[model samples]
Target: MRQNLSVEEALEAILEGARPIAELEPLPLAQAYGRTLGAELSARVSHPAADDTAVDGYACREADTRGASPENPVRLRVVGLAPAGQPFSQEVGPGQAVQVFTGAPIPLGADAVVRVEDTRREGEFVWLLRPASPADIRRRGEDLVEGQTYLHKGDLLTPARVGLAAAMGHPVLPVVRRPRVGLLTTGDEVVEPGEPLPYGGVYNANSYTVAGLVEEAGGEPVFLGKAPDSPEELRTHLAQTQGLDLLVTTGGVSMGERDVVRKLLEAEGQIHFWRVRIQPGGPLLWATWNGLPLLGLPGNPVSAMVSFLLFGRPLLFRLLGRSDPPYQQLRAVAETRFEANPARRAYRRGILRWAGGYRVASTGSQSSVVLRSMAVGNALVVVEAGKPVRAGEEVEVIPLPGGKTAG
Candidate 1:
């Protein structure tokens, strides 16, 4: 097995450096988020059925209202009114106007909307000052043509993207189902949560934490909980992942006597690599059991998280068939002088926010045991192994919770 690798090398191994996640079941549109998009969604009946109002304004015939200036002004009869969510098919005669709200369909025979602001209303007739131009009109299907394609296949269904699909008339969205992940955590010193922790022992947060991250990354997290260091226990855990799309384990990956996770996996599965040249997350591991993907992350909080992000997260996303197989990476500037001289990639827990036009990040302490930093941090500042970075320098970052956070 390979050892002492860069974070990218570990990620490449996790991506299998080759074979992709097998196909998954078809999913519904409503439950698409936290799942991947396997197929592209096409337009059913096009969009914006016809020329409609883009703003709340008066719909008037262009010919009748054209050149109706502020000085001379043209008077037009108000024949009818139309509100949003409703459309009127009645044709507008010359010198006639229709009170229109935003999104209201422009009546037939009317080519322009002289905004209500530009027109003075009367009981039956309205006085228009500004000249209505072709620009004022939202041409029929101007937003989308008939049978035009709106959403492409293989796009992640974010709230905004999902909304777009909904607008495009996807009733039952055809999406790839969330890939199921079997989460296994191993450590002799680690105890199951909700129980007593003896001296030098703590609860198992990696299981729940990484599971949550898996879900946010668009996969179903199957909580396998903590597995003992025994080969039988490890075998049972690995066996339980029979139908799962992926299996991710925390701890028991280092080359220690008690680090039996890899050994147990090796009994049946093939070990591809072990160890990485990264701070806080060096003892990373990867394997394949019966053709199912397996990941062995460092047990420390920060290491596990970094391993999950750089390795497991993207693999899970692709397996689920996310519209975008690989997630989008963002760039941010270092908010303060951050120090690291480790021989491996350093993922510093930190917070990032927008200042002026730049997104800057501050490095929180890089301690693997620090949970408070993870709680407060919005982004993970990525520093290459042995790379020294100063304040105002640029670095890569991944959001902590995987969505927009409220300041």
Candidate 2:
């Protein structure tokens, strides 16, 4: 086990040797939502493919409309009609025009489109009431060019990206396989929710919390249930996750006699780090068991969840090959004064209100065990080690899932 390290140092240590998982799976466009692209996707076909009309209009040579006005409009013979997906076979010539609808291919030899409203049509004759410019044409490749890369590797398949893929004629996309994470909650006194709770026992909230967090981080959670305090029973639980990409456990990492997670990992595999220099999550542990990365979080509900957000989530992103995933920092004004730990960074739950600049108010007592404070907070008011913040002072904040502190 390594010595206690600062939060930054711990993060660096955890990710220093990390490498993205190299598993690719082909998925249909409809099933690729929320999946990360495994490779750069180039456009297969240019959008529009050809110059087209942007509105229902007359396709004619720009020079034909010159000097044309409402008083003495230039008259042209209507040669043919071009509706969307049906192009006029005949080209536009001098004193000739083609009726074109929105998205219709611009007739050959026509340099501009005169809106239908700007022309008067009577049988095969049309009168242009105003001059037209070449700017009215929607040229080929205006939206996306063929052979150009539109989506890059590691991009999440959002709705817009999916639409782009469809527009580019990609029926299937190569996506990274979601990391399989084995989740185990370790504590003899922790009872599964809905089960009869004995005296001195608490419901296993950490399991559900970590499972949901794992799914949001782009992982497929394999719940291994609770691991009893006995080393033998813990070993049985650990053995069930042989093929998982990573293993995560809440509880049993603290410096207590029943903290079997750290001791078991150290004995069977390797414990690279045991602690971090951060409040509410100082007892976090990282290790590797049988070649699979293992992250052990504290037993407290809030500490376990906060540590997952800070550490486990990033690891999952790295595994999916994402360089960055939209987590950002912003500055806010403190509505209440707060003290910080002399040696550890602190994450205080707060609600951020926008008034000129962001003003943040603490949810309640910043205790590690207080889960209610985290539920009402949309921002994490960050404080550096040894830094005491005063009311109205500008402080850094990290926006949570729901946010008002970000752009």
| Model 1 root-mean-square deviation | 2.9
lDDT of each: 0.74, 0.88
Per-candidate TM-scores read 0.88, 0.94
- Candidate 2 segments whose C-alpha is farther than 4 A from its true place: 402-407
Q: Write the per-residue lDDT of candidate 2 for residues 1-407, one digit (tens) a residue.
A: 68688877788777777788788999999999988899999999998899999989899999888988999898999999999999998778998899999999998899998998999988899998998767889999999899999999989898899999999989999999999999999898999889999999999988887898888778899999888998999999888988898899999998888899888887897999999988889999999887888899999988998898888888888889975663668899899976788998988888887888888888878888788877778888888889978898999988775344532
lDDT of 1 at 310: 73
> Model 1, stretches more than 4 Å misplaced?
17-29, 66-71, 82-90, 323-331, 357-364, 401-407
Model 2 clash pairs are none
TM accuracy, model 1: 0.88
Which prediction has the highest lDDT against the true structure?
2
Candidate 1: lDDT over CA atoms?
A: 0.74
Candidate 1 residue-wise lDDT, 104-213, digit = tens:
88888888888788878778989998876557656666655546676665666777777776777776666666677898888778888788989988788898889888
- Per-residue error (Å), model 1, residue 50: 1.8
